[model samples]
Target: MKKILRLTRHALLREQDAELRRIFGSDLEIIQVSETVPDVARVLAIIEEHRPDVVEVILPHSLTAALTRAGLVIPIIRAITRRVLHEDGTKDAPFSHYERIISLEIVSERL
Candidate 1:
């Protein structure tokens, strides 16, 4: 049996949320989180509760800083808005629509 990766997303709007669902499909168990910015405590609490394999946050600079300061070990992914495909239909791009802020292995090392 394949391992089910649990991913928690924070502050994603309707379109981004739909994109995530479309991209990840059933492979990931996606959890939606609406918390943002100064509410690091609430985000931390959600992390503790869900214990997700990965946490995806939109515009995460502040939250990332707080998580780092607090020494939380979960991996974080930063979701950014960008066209999924170019006008030429080429997939090569400087950055994906979303990017992982930290890798799971890196998080494990920190832990």
Candidate 2:
């Protein structure tokens, strides 16, 4: 059987979902959640409910800090953005192109 992955983002975009699906392919089940700002409890609840192989969280730094302070055991991938800025400081690429995944464990270790 294929593995299941859970992805949670601040604003769930259809294009992001499609990109993820394309990357993972049909062999993996990708469960997505969209919330403006998901608290640690809500994130934990989702993990408990889904029991996914890995949980990818695309949230702001503040919330990610809270999650780290909460000390969650489940593996988490922090989805970062690498955007190209225009002369006016506007983003030049789509959201998909800016996504960069990093493990929470690695993030914590650096601290």
Candidate 3:
């Protein structure tokens, strides 16, 4: 089983749910967070409470900068995406174009 802590809007979470289902299969847990920009304290609280194996930061917003300063060691999967606009000027997706997936290992080399 896998634990995933996702930071994304509730309304714009369908994409993530589908992705997670394909990635982690049916043996995974997803904890949804509505914070556009989550501070260290809030992140820490969630981690401590749920003990998620990894945190999926969809809307990173200010999380990267804040986490860098705090120097927390954890597995963070960052989703980089761009909003898509249809030809008729319609927004069909919350976001599209799976640009790149960044895997950040917040840890120092163990010597």
Give the Cα-based TM-score of candidate 1 against the true structure.
0.50
Tens digits of per-residue lDDT for model 2 on 1-111? 234444454554566556655655656666666655447777677677878765677666656666666755555564445578889877764464324333233254443
Task: List, in order, the clash count of every candidate structure.
Answer: 0, 0, 0
- Candidate 3 residues lying further than 4 Å off, grouped into runs, are 11-15, 35-38, 68-73, 94-111
TM-score of each: 0.50, 0.54, 0.60
lDDT of 1 by residue, 37-104 (tens): 35678777777887776666553455566665666565566656445677888764233465655522
Better of 1 and 2 by lDDT: 2
User: Candidate 1 vs candidate 2: which has greater TM-score?
Assistant: 2
Residue 5 displacement in candidate 2 (angstroms): 4.4
Question: Which residue window of length 10 is worst by lDDT in model 3?
Answer: 96-105
lDDT of each: 0.55, 0.59, 0.61
Per-residue alpha-carbon lDDT of candidate 3 for residues 1-111, written as tens digits (9 for 90 to 100): 888777666443567567766766778887777675546677767667777877765545456546545544556665545677899998754544232233334444778
